[model samples]
Target: MSHPHPELSSPPPLGKGALRVVALGGLGEIGRNMTVFEYGGRLLIVDCGVLFPEEEQPGVDLILPDFDHIRDRLDDIEAIVLTHGHEDHIGGVPFLLRERPDIPLVGSKLTLALITAKLGEHRIKPETVLVEEGQRQDFGPFDLEFFSVNHSIPDALAVGIRTPGGSVLHTGDFKMDQLPLDGRLTDLAGFSRFGDEGVDLLLSDSTNAEQPGFVVSERDLNEDIEKVFRTADKRIVVACFASHVHRVQQVIDAASQHGRKIAFVGRSMVRNMNIARDLGYLSIPGDTIIDVKQLDKMRPNEAVLICTGSQGEPMSALSRMASRDHQIRIEEGDTILLASSLIPGNENSVNRVINGLTRWGANIVHKGNALVHVSGHASAGELLYILNMVRPRNFMPVHGEWRHMRAHAELAKKTGVSDDRIVIAEDGVVVDVYKNRAKIVGAVQAGYVYVDGSSVGDVTDAALKDRRILGEEGFISVVLAVDSNTGKILGEPEIHTRGAGLKPDAFDDVIDKLQDALDKAASDGVNDPHQLRQLVRRNAGRWVNETYRRRPMIIPVLVEV
Candidate 1:
């Protein structure tokens, strides 16, 4: 008889193997927001996300969770439920499905539409189950009800997965925006119903866990933005996230109110806007929004440009315009409204854009104690309110930093949630909920997988370390000859070095100093290639550090004679 590995079975089988929440990443950062609900051997994932690596991690583009622990159980992974169309929540789906095909994905109509489009970009399309708000679906052993939640992006929702353990509310990025620009609010009624229905375990967004009070309403932005638009007599280039349909709607309304035609620039902004408008999610009056190519015939005073790169993304139209390289130029009196906040890790890029706008005689505005961008996550009061609404026996805070999760957990304690009820987890940490309590159940192989261009999971720690070393020091290449039998260098050593030239003018002269050092030093009795390589590397590092104030990566090439 063939049997599965005993270790792979359910963890100790406690309390009917009751409701369990697994945080693969979202617990400790703003990006890569994902949470897993497991009950009765059925697994449903919410928001497969990816984080952008910090500056310390060079050459790495995006960081995704390593799913090897659950790779073998793909069948149990019934569906991937999305919260919104934001990159952090939906970016990793394409990479996640690369290994597991034929997986049913569940999200809102527009969310699924955006996800389908993203998959199409990869030339790999799968069946994405389009579940609207208030839609219910049942997998093998669990029942889930998804409802709309207002956020910066349209069609965002909170999920209620009902299992035998209890109903677990996975509040994806949301806020209590009563007067949302999109005219939809986070369903306090449905949430109240869940509260009335009795929730056993609650998993909520802790991204804003540290924030004290309720987040400022999204409605406040319209007043300031309307003011900006009303006063602007010249062409206005507004930058924001493409998925932020609510913000886009507000921009459209502002443009309409100002009697200015709208034109979308940048690929993603244009594509998402067209998709939303075609799907009737966004309504722009006839020729109210023109394409950039069509802008040639329109007067600049009558144009309101809505484009991507509010974060100052390099390829975005805003960046191109800032550089004065785009087909559309912002002459004097031009106004550039950076309607998005500087997402952490993108300060340099966005700051560069701001500098460029300033240099090019354009007025720029962004998040600086201003009402341009409002966060979507719930603050402390809203967090407490959700906790109180659900009245869950156990609370697991996901989607924030250690400080954030801890802050929320502490607050949960103050809100009548017992000490055992609050379980703060890190990335890959698992918490089991049974009979009104939550506790850790060890960790799984849940870490990040870096995506660098054509390579997936190629940006390894070792690679990143090597890059860091190269950046910190410089790079030294040692080419030496050794006898094959004796393991000794038979000739003079050739030392080639490049002061890790992150730029052309960074460390050009350090190579000359390294060459001088090698020319002066004599070969040692250590004929072994390995030993000689080590010696050369160590010496080169010391020399570069002392002389050029840089330590480059040292590469020793030993050729045997």
Candidate 2:
């Protein structure tokens, strides 16, 4: 309400005075993410992401990184290179453009497809220079190459960056999936080529670095999904991230094999389906995808509902269906398959949606109950595999919480990487690189920006506190009385309440009690709105608590009579 604080919460930018890569966010926590590698008067940002706070942040919408430290150096930001399509990796682009609108954005085809789709929602046309596997581009003196890597999403990759001082490889969120659902694998041979080409710095994802073994391949999930469809008795409802087109393709195959017609729901699901099908990345059988309005025409056993909201995004189609708001109401004996795992901070929302669906008599299947989800992050073995392939002089772990970063650094040490090469960073800590060597020079002013409704750079900590107070304490109203010629209030006060009062007629009665009190407070020969307003508020607050057994926020309005 008070013009939300400018999102750049920190003071200023401070670097290591050389080639420093600063973490704006996403080092310790999961979002408001960015990594800046600065050298030769040019800046290259790997990602800018947003991380949603836990359930405790009531009514506080999405939170983004404060770009203040880097905003002043916007001219040095040559490009923002991306690694994948996940929300945590790309969701903050619109927010980033809000601060520095001119940075050149680059990503693979599918990554750009998803981002452009998101930008379309705001009527904002994005300008992204598409990069593909085996292609390299230069940003001033920084050279970049996209090395394809397999993940839950299609076209995931690790970036190979060549700066003047040396070459740095940023292994974006990835895993080794030789037999991928999308038929692409991390090009270890390509990484080997980078090492052969003299790699100097390495940044890898730490998400699953603590997991002991290798990540499961998506190919392994196909058989399990096939069994679910072949065994399901009634309608099949598939819940997943809309951007996971490869998974969607697999589900479509399962549904088609079972002779079911797939009807996609959720904004993201529909949009991505449109993009993937048009781009030839997904293949659905003829007449397989039908209009939701025609759902009744299909037989119950042949109905497949592919919906979004796997994580209980309130507006997603599956969440609405849980509330019985969707056109295709879930019925008894329907098989609801949650094809995505619960993200760290979204367990509550996801479980709530599952509970709501179960209450409607649908049997829900998730992890442990079925083969539904597999993480795209690398496990210990896979992490080792990547480190061995890219053999760099320095290493940094990214893409996880504080624990993940620590675990990953430990893993690197265990895999023959020395402690000095592993640089553990947090949000705003800049690492300076020069002549193929790197070290943490100092810190940068990096923090988060909050986006609520149409307000960007709003919802600072102060705004969040205000929202929390409004949510918890509600609001109070006070009435004051003044003599016709003087400002004064009565001894007793009136109580007006919304959240604290149980009485239905409380506010109506409050007006009368307030007028009575005001008449008493009136000055003999003076009447003033400001003075009366203050008196009304103070008395109303005290009176409400005493008479109604509760207190609410006090707002006083005074009118001269």
Candidate 3:
């Protein structure tokens, strides 16, 4: 029961000044959780994270917070402090290290280890310092104290910073699970201690602010999952978040309890679990772990498989398994367990995968059907409890959508925090705190940076818009060749269409109209290559829309021979 006892070792001479806070991301969103804190001339960043791309972000691999403001003030940054190792909280480490590799990164041991592995992919070896709960360290202009917090991942932390203006507490993603699988509870006592010290401003995770009542404990899943393993006559495959070490540990324990050997699927699950086991965060007996390739040798009832892709990501091991494209095929009577929550906006994909599994005659079990998963965020009751415990003069809710933040703000008012004391923020909004007084000041560039196949921020909204158009309406390309010496038409306009849902015969009328328009335009002295290209595009686009009621992308090419 090592709780957070963040006591400053050496205190610098204090200067009562304004503390600036910036929500670079995570406000009004679910991912990309980054926040900037500045006092005097030095700055300290709490988290550098990323978000998974949604359906609208086609061809994008990851979405990151816009670091334009930080890029301009890199010299002022003192350190990067991390709360946990979940992707949304630590996914952007490599991207940030690529820009400023010299900045020191501090976090719990497992948190730093996870990011270190990520930085290795980019050939970056950053300066990393491992700090745990009860440890207090000083970074220029800031005194940081770390405390243990219960999350789905092991060794998650919350931070308290002593600034010139006052003490600021940041509760990174957490839940008050009295019976956590790891036996480490959310340090409510530590928060109360900080409250007694007169916290100036508090920034708490609002991810589950709208969720009512208490969340189910991680320990509660053990019995139900073990029952599945005990009664299953065939193989059992479980899908969960790759970073959920606690859940993975429970799955392993269940397998061992049922006399079943375990196999790890999905690249991320294998890698992250290995890291956890090597770091002593996970305990797996060598005899119980088997390779996926060896599954054929084991009896169906003697094995358990754990994989990623609980969200139904197409490339994940579970999704591929559902499609019968993976090494292990789903057989009749097999039990497929999804030990994760369905992320918002991912219902269709998850349902599709589940339907595919069901069609194969495998029994599908998920949180929707049973008590398999619990959120790692504080629900409304827990949020109110924290608000009452850590009675900070100012409050800012982070790490959720606008609705969640607003709900949490209203809850704060219920706990006696004044309306002026709670600042509702979106991405890029800056709030300044001076002597326990907080107010909205200004803003900075806090937009999305789309990552597409080795390119960062190269994809624009306009490009995505065109992609959506092409996906919906397809595209049409027209080529016209004219004599170079004389301004005369050369031949019939060559037209090509793809994915437009129209056959050549169906496009004949449009093509005839385009040819006639081209002849008329050339006769009207519109023979300039640029003008000819524009004329073809305009006429072709107009005819397609007026006739077919579809506006596909039209590409016009004018070749002067």
Query: Which prediction has the highest lDDT against the true structure?
Result: 3
RMSD of each: 4.8, 4.3, 5.8
lDDT of 2 at 369: 87
TM-score of every candidate relative to the true structure = 0.90, 0.87, 0.95
- The number of clashing residue pairs in each candidate reads 9, 25, 0
The whole-model C-alpha lDDT of candidate 3 against the native structure comes to 0.87
lDDT of 1 by residue, 205-293 (tens): 88778888888888788888998888877888889988888788888888898899888887788779878988889988896866678
> What is the C-alpha local distance difference test score of candidate 1?
0.78
lDDT of 2 by residue, 445-528 (tens): 565666778886656767676566667767775544444564444334444556654564656666665666556544343356
lDDT of 2: 0.77
**C-alpha lDDT of residue 511 in model 1:** 48
TM-score of 1: 0.90
Top-TM-score candidate index: 3
Per-residue error (Å), model 2, residue 460: 2.3
